[model samples]
Target chain A: MRIAVIQFPGTNCEHETLVAVRDAGMDGEIFRWNRPEQELSEFDGYIVPGGFSYQDRLRAGVIASKEPVMATLKEEAAEGKPVIGICNGFQILVESGMLPGSGEIDLALAQNVMVKGGRIVRRGYYCGWTTLRHESLPRRSCGSFLLDGGALLQMPIAHAEGNLVTAKEGLIQELADEDQVIFRYCNSSGTAVDEFPVNVNGSTENIAGICNPEGNVLGMMPHPERAIFSWQLPPPGRRPPGPGPGRMVFESMRRFIEVSR
Target chain B: MRINLRIWLKIPDAEAATVKNTLVRRMGFEGVIDDVRRERLYSIEADVGNPWRLVKHIVRELVNENKEECLVSIDELDLDDGYVPVKVGLHIEDGEAISAKNRLVRRLGLSAVKRVERSNIWKLYIRSDEREAVAEEIARKLLINPNKDSYEILRARARAVGMRQ
Candidate 1:
């Protein structure tokens, strides 16, 4: 499968995403988003990694969302081609009005409240590595909001504005109805439990990932590329391999390509 | 590679996490590994693009918007003999409302106030230096004509935290 990773002005993770795609047993290519008019249809799918594209001007992903390439991205997303965006890329996706939650994300932009009901306002919340486990349904949080909702997967979340915010109907709920939420921020057991530190970013309903209406487009904040191997484990303790959510996403995309072939 | 800015804040854990998350998620760095327990160490891998420029832009945004999170480096903070917990707060007012004027800090009886850009919020670069002296300087300078309720709250907090001047 030919995969195109979008490289914008401020994107910092394009190479990592590139490595991720190549590691997934697929042909990974870096494509410049500035060259939006280029024939991107040749690639099987596109991955928009994270970064302050255009310095996150006028709000995160706002400028990049209006860039020349996004016009083509919107068209492709409409066509049901698989597209994945991580972190700021997800912000761009939402800012461009591609995600379900209106256009802007009402994210909680403070420190992580481990055990939400705390007296002292803590400082660092997005640090440390949590064991990723698949959720029955994907949920949004301050960590990852790029994965599809309603799917269970374990992926490392890293972000502050990752708090999933939606339009009037509660975008997360609407995505849940379509089984589009593909990731969740849950306890080690994969149960839909909410507590301090467990949910990490105070995402609504512990939502960590979500998908487009067609389920073909996946966007989440967690870096699945960072967790491809067991050696990457920062003392996984006794957790098993079922919750390696990154592979699930990669596998799913690979399968989509395989089936297409 | 990432630059380190050492500032003091109310909370450590949550603020560190939030900043790191912003670095990795919104800013889209490979990752940010903590250095030690010093609340400043961050790691970001090289990207296809120039990350230094990106980091500079992201850091400026964070410092301007996230006043409660960012600070000037440990080295810079050490220069202030008073050991003030200095968190550089840059307050944005209208167009070119503020500029980096070190002499003004001295003239207003203030040690130093790092000012940059016409951002929305006051980017207070608070460092863990001489808290008392810096707070006093702030009181004398910026707090001279204060916002009633807000200043009252700040005064109370500063007094409670043993702010000197």
Candidate 2:
């Protein structure tokens, strides 16, 4: 399957993301944002990788969301094609009103607030490894298609505005009922927590990732590409040589495309 | 009493330029939007006697005299008439503003400072007759995300009864 790793200006993770895609047995290339929008249709799937797009001016992803390329990407996504947005990419999707798939702005990845013991401990940019528990059914979402429900995957998340919040009432419950709530920040034992470090970015209900109702569009905060290989994990020398937990995300995408076609 | 510190970059503001570029080239505001300028506004509520003297110290602590310039207004916000000023701020808990308040009170020992509220003033030089409407549209479409942020359009107002610097 051919996957397009979209590389917006200031996108620093496209190379690694592309590598993970190829390593997952899918052919992929970095697709620049300035490229012809129509040319994007040739790819079987799309991945909007993370970085400070448009220097995150005016807000994290609002500037990039207004681009014509995003319009085309939205169109591509409506056709039931898989589009996985990671970190800044997730912010872009939320800003572009593509995450909820409602074609209207419904959520915001506000500034990070690290709360512990009911007190604000820290805020702003943070980078560290986190455990994500798959909350959706197997094959429920494209990015987590191959991951079983309750499966925990370890990945690193580096961001300033990853806190998912919504003003729309009952929206979070609706997502949960629809199984659109895909991945949630959890402890090593796979229990979703609501505190700093365990909950990571103070996202609503510890949500780390979500997908649209169609299950094709997915937006996640953690960087799976950064954890594709075991060597990339922390406490370096002690870990065994093998594929990392993050490999499943990419592999699942490939499997989803194959089965969908 | 409130001390409003209006800070603007003496150097080129890349954020304003990017906003202008997006409004004109991307969001179809080409002829309607002539220019876009931005300023950081920090409204400090203090209960100190001879507040004017204390403002000098607050300004010293907050404003960087080299790359930035500050305009201090006591109890009111006044702006030039040419553009529509839209003030955007986080409706949720503002961590930075809270940190600033703590720094002024606990760190700098400015006990008179009761609270600090921070926001960005987006001055939109609109060429349309419906400047306010267009400004609101720009604020909704690009400036503020309703989930975490809220915005207000600052129209022309009577000058502050207090002193201006």
Candidate 3:
């Protein structure tokens, strides 16, 4: 199986994601944004890796979403090809109106909230390890197959505007009902919570990742690729003797493709 | 023709007050000065011949699609006049506005002042005769952040006949 890692001008996570894909035993290739749409469509699966695309100008992922490649990516996703967007890639997916399968976008990853003294203000940038748990759903996708319900996975999150919000009420419930919500911020025991420190960016319902209604396109803020190596984990006790939690993400995708064939 | 554009957030007065107070308190200002307004937004300026098509494209492509309403105004200018007035505004919208204001109020002391709004304005200076096409291309392809804001073009008047300054 071959996976295409889409690279935008400011994307920095492509190399790492490519490494993770190759480690999972799938052929991985880097596809620049400027490449022709026909060439990009050749890949069986795609990953829009994270980075400060377009300098995070006009909101993170806003400018990149309008690029020519996204038009083709959107089309590929519509045909049920697996498309995973990590961090900035996730932002681009939402900005491009691909995730949640909302047809129209009414949500955004707003500025982070920082509580100082007693007042809440916008936080600039944050980077650290976070725990995520899978949300049980009947519709299976390669991106979410391995994550058992309530299983905890350690990952890193680095961003400023990571707070997920929607202007409309009940949107969170709508996503949940659709089985689009795939991951939630949780404690070590895998209990989902909305309180801060545990839920770093204050996402609604502690959502860490989500897929579209069709279950093919996934967008998540955490850096799963960065956690593929055991040493990448924080603290000695949390580290395992083998590959880290991130391997499951890629492995699941590869497994899904192999099984489907 | 040269066109000046003003963009601002359509925020409620009550909410704007909270933002102004927070800026003054957090940034260590001696209260907001008379001319400066507070809000997180952007401004852009480009010189083009016809301002209509450019502003229309900007509104369609660059402004926010959500209910976070934004206004873009083209200041009235006489092509013969050399000076143009430019303004821009940025404001937090929907739930964010209230959340930001509440957070600021909680952290900083409350203030008696009622209203504060945020936006950005752009001043475009054009000397060329081919304004419409150039401006449209610039607005559609070059301007930034169309998904989070909105825009408009104010009709130009003939320097208001003979007005008393």
| Candidate that would win on DockQ | 2
- The parts of candidate 3 lying over 4 Å away from their true place are A114-122, A236-240, B1-116, B122-165
lDDT of 3 at B101: 36
Alpha-carbon local distance difference test for all models:
0.51, 0.92, 0.66
Better of 1 and 3 by DockQ: 3
Worst 10 residues of 2 chain A by lDDT: A231-240
**Better candidate number, 1 or 2, judged by lDDT:** 2
- Sorted by lDDT, highest first, which candidate order results? 2, 3, 1
Candidate 1 wrong stretches, greater than 4 Å:
A101-115, A118-125, A131-153, A236-245, B1-165
Each candidate structure's TM-score, on Cα atoms with residue i matched to residue i, is 0.55, 0.98, 0.68
Candidate fnat values, all: 0.00, 0.88, 0.00
DockQ ranking, best first: 2, 3, 1
Better of 2 and 3 by TM-score: 2
The best candidate by TM-score is: 2
lDDT of 3 by residue, A173-232 (tens): 998887788888888888776666777876777888999877888899999899998988
Q: Write the per-residue lDDT of candidate 1 for residues A1-261, one digit (tens) a residue.
A: 788888887888888777777766888888997564557877878888877676653245655665667778777766766788887777677666666533333221222334465532332326445544444332222122334543444456666556554324554566777766656676666665565566766556776666665566666767777666544556656556543446556656776656545
